[model samples]
Structure formats: structure tokens, C-alpha cells
Target: MEMIYLDNAATTPVLDEVVEAVADCLRNYFGNPSSLHRLGIRSEKLIKEAADSVGAVLHVDADEIIFTSGGTEANNMAILGTALARQRTGRHLITTAIEHPSVLRVFDHLKSQSFEVTYLPVDKSGLISPDRLEKEIRPDTTLVSIMHVNNEIGSIQPIEQLGRIIKSINPNTVFHVDAIQSFGKLGLYPKKWGIDLLSLSGHKIHAPKGIGALYVKKGVRLQPILFGGGQQRGYRSGTENIAGIAGLGAASKFIRRELETKSAYLYDLKNRLVAGLKDALPQAVINGSLESGAPHIVNIGFPGMKGEVLLHALEDEGVFVSTGSACSSRDRTVSHVLKAVGVDDRIAGGSIRVSTSYLTTMDEIDAFISILASVVSRVEKYSRR
Candidate 1:
């Protein structure tokens, strides 16, 4: 059987152009960006040009961008770096319960250090209300981190509204957005949105893994997390990954050029998959607010079946999808995101995430639905036995 890959939210296949760009950089530009020699200068120029491309796309200054290993590190640098640097201002922070582990874990670590953290709850639609946020703001709240789009359910948060509310209530509280899942797929203007910091991952947008960026609004003070040769404006100290950065730059350019076309295609694919699942399994329940989600992901739960069982059953049929976020999939635990949105444990336990990308096709979707229908039927039969 032909394999149908539907796990784009977890990670996407690297675009061929991106692969070639990375290979070209690895082959031709292997010099350290920090060295003063000719080779080093050549590498440094490439890094600067890459930064310029990324910055231009995001409408931020190139100097404000700091390259890291991926979204996890970028989030760590943003949350921890900002809190530590501005600790004198306050020791309190705020975030949502649905944020990725990167952001949530960093906050948990900070809580261990005596930083008060308030995890605001989301409504049934998986949205954090600005009104709820306003009620939670304290005098000591120094930073507020919220994700632009949820990784599992693809629910788009009211970021611009939240930003305005936070600024109005506590202008000193720096606003950070983890846009890893939304960056390339959505229209993001950090400055205009009042976002003080934004994190992005390359792999989510068809670039290679191990390369990501944290955009710090200029003049925002953040303590250096890594100590080294003062790279990334001394904020994230380390030699840059020239090849990965080159791939990221190329990927950014490609996405910028094709976003409108790619987005429409993804929207169609997602709608088709959701409609097919609902039609095939009328008992299937979608997990979040459909109207407010990104076009590429849909989370569905089937009653009386385990998510892991369905996951492997589909895999056995040559269909690929995910239970939820790839990072948290191993635990076999119910998704916190689902619980936050009021999904019962029974339904949440059976949830499967089917995500698509620009590269996904109609044939893949049809094949996936066919496999899924058979799998769900088999699971139901076994349960009845």
C-alpha cells in the first residue's frame, strides 16, 4: 500500500530546494562566522544575509533575530532570558495551559526559582480570553507568553486582542508569542501586534530541523543564556549553523512567495479530510473550535477507542498521523490541551490529529480516510468482542 503521511504539525519533510541550499552551504561555506579571516568573513556575510531575509519577512530588524537549535531553545531564551534580565522589575509571569512544553516547562523551572506563574485556562473553544487575562494580571506580573496557534488542535488565539489588553493593563509586562506552528502559515506582524518577542521553528515550514529563530523587539533587554564568542548579538552565544540557517532563509523566501497559494491548498485538504472523517464516522467528534483554527490541522476523537490503538492501527494500514504533539506522544497520557478545552477523558483518549501541509495531496487524503475508516471499524469490532 502507498503510505499517506499526514503528520505535518509534528514535522514536515524538508523541501528539495531547502535541502540543496543546506548542502550548498555545507559544501561551500564551512568557515566560522566569528573568525576575522576571509573564509570567516564569507560565512559571516551569509549569516547576515540570512538574518536580513528572515527579518524582512517578519518586518523586524535583522540584528534582533537570534538563531537557536529550534523552537524549544528559542522559547527557552525568550521566557527565561527575559524573566532573569528583568527580574528586578517583577518575579511574576503569565501563560496559557495549552502552550507547548517548551514554554510551559521553562515557566515550571522558573516557578521552582520562586517566580510566580499563573496559567490561565482556555474556554471550550480552546481560546484564552483577554478578559480573563486582565483579571489575572498582578502588579508583579513581568512577562506574558501566549502561543499564536495551538500545536495539537490548530486553534488560533486572539493574539492581537490579547496584546492590546496586556499593554493597556501592564505595559511593562513583555508579551511573547510562540509562533512556531503559525509563523509560515499565517500573517504575523509582531510589531504591529504588540508582540515583544516571537519564536519560530524552521522544520515546521519545510526547512530542516535544528534551526530556529527568536525575534526580540529592538531595545528589549534580555540576558544572555549561553556564554561563548558573543554570537547572536551576545544574547545566544554560539557559532551559527551556517548550513541550517541558509536552508531556513531559503525556506522563508519560498514560503513568502507561495503562502497564498499554499494556504488555499492546505485549507482545501484539511476541509476534505475533516468532512470525510465526519461522513465516514458520524460518531467522530472534532476536538476544538473549527472556525478559529489554522487550515492545516484537524483533531478528531472517536468514542470507544484508544488514541494509541488508532494511531498504530492506521500506521499498520500505511497511514501516518499523530496522537498529538510529537514531543508528548510517547507518554500515552490524555492530552492536557483536550482537557483544557473540556473534552472528557474517554473522548480525549481516542483523539487523533491529522495535519496536512503544502506538499499534501488529495490522493493522500482519500487513502488516509479509507485506512482510517477500516481501522476504526476494526477497533470497534474488537471492543465489542
Candidate 2:
């Protein structure tokens, strides 16, 4: 059977144009960017052009962006780098409880090192309160990291307001945002919003895997995470992934060209899926705020049914989906995100994440609704049996 893929929060299928761009680089731009010869210069120029494309989408200067292996590395570079560099200023760091493992794990490591961390809690809708943040921020807070969109529940944090609040309370406190899930889908202006660091993943935006970038606002100090030949101005030292960089730039350019319309297209598909699911399955419970959440993701729960069972049954029908963040899905432990949102064990066990992308179609949404309703009915009845 033909497949209907909906797990966009995990990753996206690379765009055709991006594939060609990467292939073109691999075929011709094989010189190391660090070499001083003409071949190296040509490779370096491609890297620069890619940075220019990504920078334009972010409203940042080309120099402010540094490429990384992927979002995980970018998050580490921003959180750990900023924390260690600014430790002299203050050792206090703050982040939300529902952040991705990349951010949370680094904080865990910090905790082991005796650095104080404050984990902000979210509401039932998986959103943090501005007043709560205003109260939690302190004069000694060195860095605050938050993700713009939750990969599982799709809740969008009020990043601009939060940034302003952090700066107002402590002008010197650095703000870092993990924009991995929101980069291509949402309109973001980090410079205007007072964000000191922002992370991006190419694979999430139809670019190749193993490539990402970090937006380091001018004058923010971060210690070097990777020690090497001092590429990327010593911030991240390594030879540039020339082909991956070219693919990333191509993806950014394509996404930015018609982002408004593309965003609308995603929202339209999301609304249909949500409305259709609710109409078909009243027992269905949505885990995130439908009105203000990210347009590309939704988490639906069916009481007494198992999320893994739902996942496998849907796969049997050639409709692909996931239970939660792919990074942590294999652990068999309960979802930390659902736990943070106060979900009961039964509902949380049955929740399945449904995420869309710019390339997702209306017909796919319609078909998923029909297939999902059928699967849920069978699964619940089988559980009763």
C-alpha cells in the first residue's frame, strides 16, 4: 500500500530541489573550505551563499550564524557554551520542564556540576505563564533557554514577551531559543525579539540530515564547544559540511519564498485534521491548545488504548505516525511532556502525535482522519475484549 506520512515533528522528507543542490555540491565542490587554493575558495563561496540564505530568513547578519552538525549540537553550543562562559557573571540558569532532551540533558549535566537550574512548569495546555516567568527570573540568572514550539504537543511559547521579561528583570541575562520545529513554519525575528541565541535543524525543514545552524546575536560570548582548526570563527571548530550547507541554504530559500502562503496551507490542513478527529471520535482528547498551538503538530489521546499499539496499527494501514519525540520514543518510559501537562497514565499512554509539514496535502489529512477513526475503533474494542 502507498504510505501516508504524518510524523513531521520527527523529521521531514527532503525536498527535490534540495536533493539536487546537495548532489551538485558533492559532485563538484569537493575541495576543503579551509584550503587557500581556487577549489577551496569556490567551496567557501558556496558556504557563504548558504549562510546568506539562512541569514535572510532569520533577519540576521551572515557572520552571526554558525553551522553545526544538527539541532542537538546547536542546542549544546548555545546552552552549555553560554552557561560556562557566563558562569562568572552568575551560575543560575533557567529553562522549561518540557524542553527537548538536548536542552534538558545538558541542564542535567549542569546540575551534576553544581550549577543551579530552575525548571519552569507549564499549564494544562503546555504553556508557561509570563507572570510566572517574570517572577522566576532573577538578577543572577545567567541564561534562559526555551523551545519555541513543543514537538509533541505543538504549544507555542510566548517567546517575544518572555525575552522582554527576562531582559527587563536582568539586562545581562542571555536568552536562547530552540527554534528547531518552528524555523521554516513560523515567522521569527530573533534580533528584534532580544533572543541571544537560536537553534535550527536542516532535516526538520526539508534539508538534509546532519546539518543545522546557531544564530549567535552580536556580542554574546560563548565558550568553544568543539576544539579544532578554528573554523566558524572558533565558535564551532571543524571543516564545514559543504554539501549539507548548500542543501540547507537551498531549503531556506525555498521555504522563505512563499512562507506566508505555505504557513496558511499548513494551518488549513491542521484545522481539518483537528475538526475531523473531534467530530469522529468524541472520546479523543487533544493534549495541546488547539487555538494557539503550532499549526504543524497535534497530540491526540484515546483513553485505555496504548499509544504504541495505535502507532503499529496505523503503520499496518500504511499511515505513518509517532507516539512522541522520536529522540525519546524508544525508551518505553512515559512521556515527560505529557507528564508535565498533567495527563493521566491512561490517556497519556494512548496519545499519538500527528505533525504536518509544508509539503503535506489536504487529501492526506482527509485520508488520515478516516483511517485513524477506523483504527481507534478496532483498537479500543480489542482492548475491551
RMSD of each: 1.2, 1.0
Each prediction's total of clashing residue pairs, residues at least 3 apart in sequence or on different chains, is 0, 0
Please list the residue runs of candidate 2 whose C-alpha ends up more than 4 Å from where it truly belongs after superposition. none
Taking the tens digit of each residue's C-alpha lDDT, what string does model 1 give over 66-133? 88999999999999999999999899999999999999989989999999999999988889888899
lDDT of each: 0.89, 0.92
Candidate that would win on TM-score: 2
Clashing pairs in 1: none
TM-scores, each model vs. reference: 0.97, 0.98
Error of 1 at 379 (Å): 1.8
